[model samples]
Target: MTQKIEFIDLKAQYRALKDAIDARIHKVLNHGQYIMGPEVRELEERLEDYTGAKHCITVASGTEALLISLMALGIGPGDEVITTPFTFVATAEVIVLLGAVPVFVDIEPDTCNIDASKIEAAITPKTKAIMPVSLYGQPADMDEINAIAERYGLPVIEDAAQSFGATYKGKKSCNLSTIGCTSFFPSKPLGCYGDGGAIFTTDDVLAKACREIRVHGQKRRYYHTRIGVGGRMDTLQCAIVLAKLERFDWEIEQRMKLGARYNQLLDKHGYQRVKQRNDRTSVFAQYTVFVENRDAIAKQLNEQGIPTAVHYPVPLNRQPAYKDICHGTVTAVAERVAKQVMSLPMGPDLAESDQQRIVAALSEAVKIGGF
Candidate 1:
């Protein structure tokens, strides 16, 4: 085995942008306005421009973004938000935190995205919103979901935590639905050095509501307009994101090329890789695939100096906390995918040679695992 492959090469990314990142950090330190400083608004403005959104509200984390979005929409007790179970817990966690119900939906097996075709059946009079997780950094069926949302007069919130730079139908992911939320957790496509996130909205009222909700619902300092949370993104984190923006475009392109190459390589060996829709693109935050004997294969990869991850090992519907409430949701697909899904090392810094090595190792590991 050669040198170990990093699951996410943040070190390589930092080394490449050391100067810009240092400058950004130093500027933030000199200003000393750590809370809600100038960099916060600056990052919001740039992200708005990047996503073509009317407003961008910086928040403390991806979970905060979802919470703020839900609060802005006035989701509360007894209200339901339709979402998939095959995603990070945050997607459903925020809904539960707000005293709302997360109505679990099945996912498309190939894409691991919320199955839009199955969403309508779950919706009822209590459904206030449709929250779709763009699992694995590929936008879900937003157009279909949006159409369904329109008919029901329900708002759509896109959980784009893993897909800041992805596009769907010629539009950016975080700008697709009624309110789009993205994360800047260090491993995300457009991550900062630490936890951060943003909310994108075209509605002025909703945007204003989100902005206030992030800061304890204050329209002005020391004045309460409504209930809110202390969810503002830190100034330094915003600055770091701004610095990362310098190379973000190049990185997105690299992700596309690398993701395409991985698909090609994996396909040549008859591996069941995640599928991407033709009308959209995935940032491949985690280049996932299905396999038999997952644990044994992962152990083999580990022994061979390659890192592997399971984006999700259990569907939210099956989790101890959610099982009772989500009983009878009937997500056979999510349950099956959770067992077989595995993520390969992915990032813009990933080398093609490394991808070849990984694929070859995986092919052999599968054989050894009795597949």
Candidate 2:
């Protein structure tokens, strides 16, 4: 019997970086300033420099990053935010949580990202922001989206949870729009041991607002300036990220090379996969491909000791919570793609042998399942 392939191989990564990770964690344990230790500021400064963003505010989680950004922008009741319907719920959840409305937009059929061309028509008087999610670590068309937002006097937020190490038109993903947010969840391209996230922006005012908002909206030690939440990224998690950053560049390079290899194999096997644009690089948070009878294919692959997953099976607009909110909204592309998409094992540490096996299993599964 062959060994089972792991999806999002964090253990392999940990084994490789044990020395650095252990040292970093030990330092944090010794300091005892777990709340907001020196490592916190150190990691923030490093990320700010990495992305060329003037400010990088580490937050509790990816969801909090989006929520805080919306709060800082003064998005409240009756305001509308135009965003893609095919994304993790957090993108729209943050908008709706603040008493605002999330206007659903269809995605590009090939890339599965927000359709920038259709965005302009969605603008209305109540439109407060445009949030585009970089699905599967590939960025949406940021330049066109930004231009549209500028024309309409609206801010654009790049939900870059999966695209942290990715680049778009020579710039980093988390620094591409008016405000950018990313996650450090264990499966992300650049992840910490546990939940962590960051927000990036060049605007000083927005930066200050985000910092205050993360700390109960306090400008000083206990003087609350605005309503806020307890959303600070713990120092230990920051320290873990700092250690991971040591080899992040190499990891990113591996991801790109492996992603290209997967694409080649899939294409050779006559499988359809997500298309990455020439102007950008995806970290390949999940190397997903399209198939008919996705559930049957996944079941066959699992039986063959190949782990398969779905980035999402349901578009947010079609969910019970959002269906009524986006009533009568048509997102044909997103709905169709959701049913066909299936993710394969993907990570910086995935071996070429494992990738070949995954592709081979997928091919067999497709044949066996008669799809």
Estimate TM-scores for all models: 0.99, 0.99
Write model 1 residue lDDT over 123-150, tens digit each, in one string.
Answer: 8889999999887888999999999999
Looking at model 1, the pairs that clash are none
Worst 10 residues of 1 by lDDT: 320-329
**Which residue runs of candidate 1 sit more than 4 Å off their true CA positions?**
none
Please provide, for model 2 over 1-371, each residue's C-alpha lDDT reduced to its tens digit, 9 standing for 90 to 100. Answer: 76899998899999999999999999999989998799989999999999999999999999999999999999999999999988999998998899999998899988999999999888889999999999999999999999999998899999999999899999999999999999999889989988999999999999999999999999999899999999999999999999999899999999999999998988887788999999999999999898899889999998888888887899998899988775227899998999899999999889999988888888888897754
Error of 1 at 50 (Å): 0.4
